[model samples]
Target: MVTMTVSHKRKDALKDVWDAVSSGWGSVTSGGVWSNAETEQEFEARLQRWENSGLAHEEAKRLGQKPPRAPRGWHKRQYPEIKRGDKAKYGVIGWARAVEVTRGANGWHVHIHAVLVLEGRQQAHERAYALGRSMHVRWNKGIAKRGFTSSKEHGLRVDVSEGAERQLAEYLAKAGEPEKAVRNSVEKAGKALAREATLGQHKIAKRGGRTPFQI
Candidate 1:
């Protein structure tokens, strides 16, 4: 079964939860990470925009006016053609994401772990790689517009793999779990196996930093 937990901190999390539910049987999958350097002010401003959008929606509804259309988020705005079932474009049938935040020596670090389900077809690997590179380039440009910067090497990452639906599901499930719960579950599974299983399950932070759960 494709099991998972949901976090309401970001709207993207809910979308990811839906993707997990609807695309459990998908074949080829691609995983990605998008990150950038941000100061505390920039991070807070980002949160403010989310809050403002939500407030505007609520206010309009309460006033008996039609709620405004939600703004296309950064990812969608960057690639307006990423519609589900659009084979001519990216063939992105399903998408899921988990946003992680933690403080470190540099500052507050925020990044996204995303899983994309691709249509089953010939040359899936080539298609997946092309999409990843495109996302990386667009991501850099998008952040630049916001006055933030990211390194070419670490700003973005995308990896495509076939027949890993279950593994991807488990990774998303763990992303939303509390640190203590995940730790306990791993311990129950036995340290040796858990260590090996999680080796590539999530990305390690640069410079020996800890993930949200590890901190």
Candidate 2:
């Protein structure tokens, strides 16, 4: 676990870096609930039927390959390619990160945390809703009464504000399993900024100048 005592300066630096890296992107969280089966086996059977269907086999044949291994759940089967396509639609710019997807006898759920560079804040929600609808996943527009909010089917929850980067970053960092690219970008930027400040101080000291950071 990488822990740091966040001073005011450090916080400001992180905010700056996050903003710089994510300026044009709108933060989006989209997901769906597949089913509410009484047992896992019932859900698996449905998935198996879908996989063995002629349509699935035709899709594999169209790609000139065998059917891919079955995903453990809906999120695993669907979200990854959708995420990549979303990013690629913007010429492979911006970030697509996911938190852990979980399943239970009651239902299965996942949240895809994304920074949409191609779509501005003005268009993010519309685009997100369109995409969510196309995927046939339940998009929840408001909070659920209990349990995981993403498990509901209202609409896609999209937000793009001044503080959005930090909010999305924090979500991705939950459970110590952050999206690799965003986590590395934030960490690298912060480190580079600190190192530059330190080097600047060292240069001033070599010239017998007072260190500005000293109070």
TM-score for each candidate, following the candidate numbering: 0.39, 0.22
| Global lDDT scores for all candidate models | 0.48, 0.36
Best by lDDT: 1
lDDT of 1 at 29: 30
Measured by TM-score, the strongest candidate is 1
Put down candidate 1 lDDT per residue, 1-215, tens digits, no spaces.
Answer: 01122222233343443343223212123222222234557657766676577678778888999987654563244322212322235566666555455435554455555566677757877877676665655444444443344564665555555444433446548656776655555444323322322343364667755666666
